[model samples]
Target: MTTESDVAYAHQPGGLLKGKVAVITGVGAAGTIGAVTAAIFVQEGARVLAADISGAQKETALSLGPAAAPFQVDITREEDVEAMFAHAVETFGRVDILVNVAGNPGGRRGPEVTVEEFESLTSVHLLGTLLTNKHAVRVMAPAGGGAIVNFSSAASFNIDERISMAYSAAKSGVNSLTKSVAVLHGAQGIRANAVAPGFTLSKKNHRVPPEAMKELGGKAALGRPGQPEEQAHVAAFLTSDRASFVTGVVVPVDGGWSARLA
Candidate 1:
């Protein structure tokens, strides 16, 4: 049911990521940033392993053509994360890039936020980033270096009532972890960075009423919410060799929302 138009983005691929093998997480849904990123990566001539916790990723990957393959993985699990990278290596020969986009939303705040809720969000966002980055380093270091793009959030940089303390804290941890990887592995030729996106009209946000969504998006200086492709384009740039000197940085693809907060 996913037509080309459903996942289309304005892109003229000039092999920005040519001859690379990438593993992208959270690529299950058709209209998600992850899925769109996979499509763009393929268009840029990178073979991709489109991974997610959902079986839908199989179909999502298939839609991107023969250069993409799907793998089901729970990024929070060490075994699953290991297998994910292993599968990528087995399928594509090596991992030249990793884009960790799998994450759950967090909204509970104040004293009402339960311990379980905090743990769940941290496990998925923070711990998941840790595990993926750990394994990716294992692959990249041995292979003479690679690039990693971890998905953070605008919540990490600003105080937003719409975001939970746990989510913000986890993403903050992601920023630190990303910096640690860059500092520790830069000499090994590995580059690690993060993308912090603002309110985006991804499939998950479609449930919000149009009026409410418009109000939320209005918070950005751009007066609009971002699109999945907008975020994907940045990820591709960071993962590509064009960004060879860019590492340990958290780029905000928030339509000047963070600047507005500043």
Candidate 2:
């Protein structure tokens, strides 16, 4: 697999994010969007603070380099989210970007789904994102401004086919938050945007049978699902100065899956 380092970036400078400080959430496991984004930011010369609810985040952040630090945080908890931002400021001096990528995957609801199940999904995806973004906005306001790149999903716009109703609703909430932040904070120098991905190749989805991957790709207009790096590339651009004029938009990195015929 050709890495980002191997490919020379032509759109902006070679290191688009040099001297920037970034805080990325939802990096519990390796190869996830959060983990991948953290690595990409590091590679692009940005210091990263990777946080997650799980402890595995330490290993993931450590793998990146000294500039990457890991913290255990639950975005649903305000204290934890606050601490995450404070930790970033204390360690990196200041924060310039935030990638709200922390979320759960097991949103499949059964006929007898409990309230706890519904709340669990909502709190993790929607509420958690709000909390993190809220703090990021507060911390960034006094610092002039910053960039916030959120993770949405194609499920927010159409049927998930996977039938994660709670997840879809939560992600839709995320889209709203993204736009709201962009509109309200652009005057303050903050650029907020989202990336909606469909069937990306991640640690979770890679477990699906190979034939299933092929089937998923066949459903998309691009004849393929997606790669984590492909999605991360878009994220990097959104958070970088190259996207200085882009805000309040949810760009789909789903290989046209969002545009397929129903």
Candidate 3:
């Protein structure tokens, strides 16, 4: 027998992200950075739209209870991107925050990387970000404000032999777009920022052999890999009131990995 009190208790406003709507794309599988970020947002009382290209978003939203919405979106496509924002507005009434997390490893390297390589990486990281922010600003500008966090990579700084040229180039574009958006829209009450992560360990890459792990850790000043939660925590602050004065900034969530390399 569900009662009104039970319903009231569930909707109770809790600070940190109370009454905020966060649309996070990239939560496909468990133990990924995307899932960790979504959990952190849910913990702080933000209604989430766990958008991903895979069916796994349904399960991710289920774990967060009723406040979360799930959508399958191919960020490379315009219609899919539009539908994602529409669903968020329909379900949560407004989008107070946007997290662009969909990214590909961009492969090791290609014998002869062509325009397709550039298009694939650019579409997901740069164009997807632009489109998401485009829709967010349309909705939030009139409402007076919003926050956006786009993901770059520590690869943006380093000349890593391991990363493909396209991936690195695309992320640099993401960083640039973040700053440009902030500069143009700051006066409108909207804030834009970026996070560049180092060789953060995740289910996908953690299966490397112990020696490889040691080599990877050595790349960071911390002498260890970074956790996804660490990045998520920084993201939470960047998108929250705590960072009200922050905009047009490229924050490095790397484990001092860039510094060590420098």
Candidate 4:
């Protein structure tokens, strides 16, 4: 029985992810990286479980039609995480890709930050990464291995006025976590990697003035803000068989902003 997760391969012409099953979190925003990735994955013939903390994922899945299924999930809770994967297995029979895209960039700068504030971002960015990978690795190990794509950020290492120290530190830990999973589970055929996006614009955050975006974009070597699709395309490559020999690296899709010196 073909499910929504893998049924895309039947109707879609692309076979990049033909017959693959994936659980994608943080697809609540229509133009966010997660949503774009889910759309591309489905286009390439993968069945997707589009999950998020909000009801927006339902709309995204509905818009994407049968290729995507929506699951409301909060990554901070262990029970929610477990149920997310269980549902994926129940619907798809087996999982081949897990894209953990839910994370927050909020926190304090300098010495004024509170512990509670730090934990808030860390819980979403760091703890969420660990919980999803932990569960995903377990499931993939028995299924002859799989691929995991976690969201990192250019702020992880590159200091910038817009970056909160907590966000950077948490994302840095995510990159490290990626490496550990790659090596520890390498023998099991599980490949782990991260995509670090820089200055990506989304329709959900229209509150930011266009001028501010231009200023931020000016900091990058490419002199422009990145579209969500650009980042998603990179993620698609990582999760697809095209990157079969690639694993354990944190790729920067930052438009050269990472290379520029402030």
- Best model per TM-score: 1
Candidate 4 Cα errors over 4 Å, as ranges: 1-13
Q: Looking at model 4, how many pairs of residues clash?
A: 3
lDDT at 38, model 1: 94
Q: Write the per-residue lDDT of candidate 1 for residues 154-262, one digit (tens) a residue.
A: 8898778767888899999999999999999999889999999999988889898988898889988999999999999999999987777799999999988999735
lDDT of 1 at 181: 95
Q: Which one wins on lDDT?
A: 1
- TM-score of structure candidate 3: 0.91
lDDT of 3 by residue, 38-137 (tens): 9999998799999999889999889989989899998878888889988999998998898888888787564555778778888888898888878778
Give the TM-scores of the predictions, in the order they appear: 0.93, 0.92, 0.91, 0.92
lDDT (tens digit, per residue) of candidate 4 on 44-144: 78999999998899999888888789999989988999999999999888899999988776646877778987989989988899999999998999988
Task: Give the per-residue lDDT of model 2 (tens digit) for 1-262.
Answer: 1124423442556787888899999887788878988888899999999999889899999898898999999999999999999999999999899999888865455455567777998898888888999999999988988899999988888885565777788889999999999999888889899999888888888788988789887767889878888888898888887777789999988888889777
lDDT of each: 0.90, 0.86, 0.83, 0.87
Give candidate 4's error at residue 63 in angstroms. Answer: 1.1
Please give the lDDT score at residue 227 for candidate 2: 83
Residue pairs in candidate 1 whose N, alpha carbon or C atoms collide under 3 angstroms:
none
Clashing pairs in 2: none
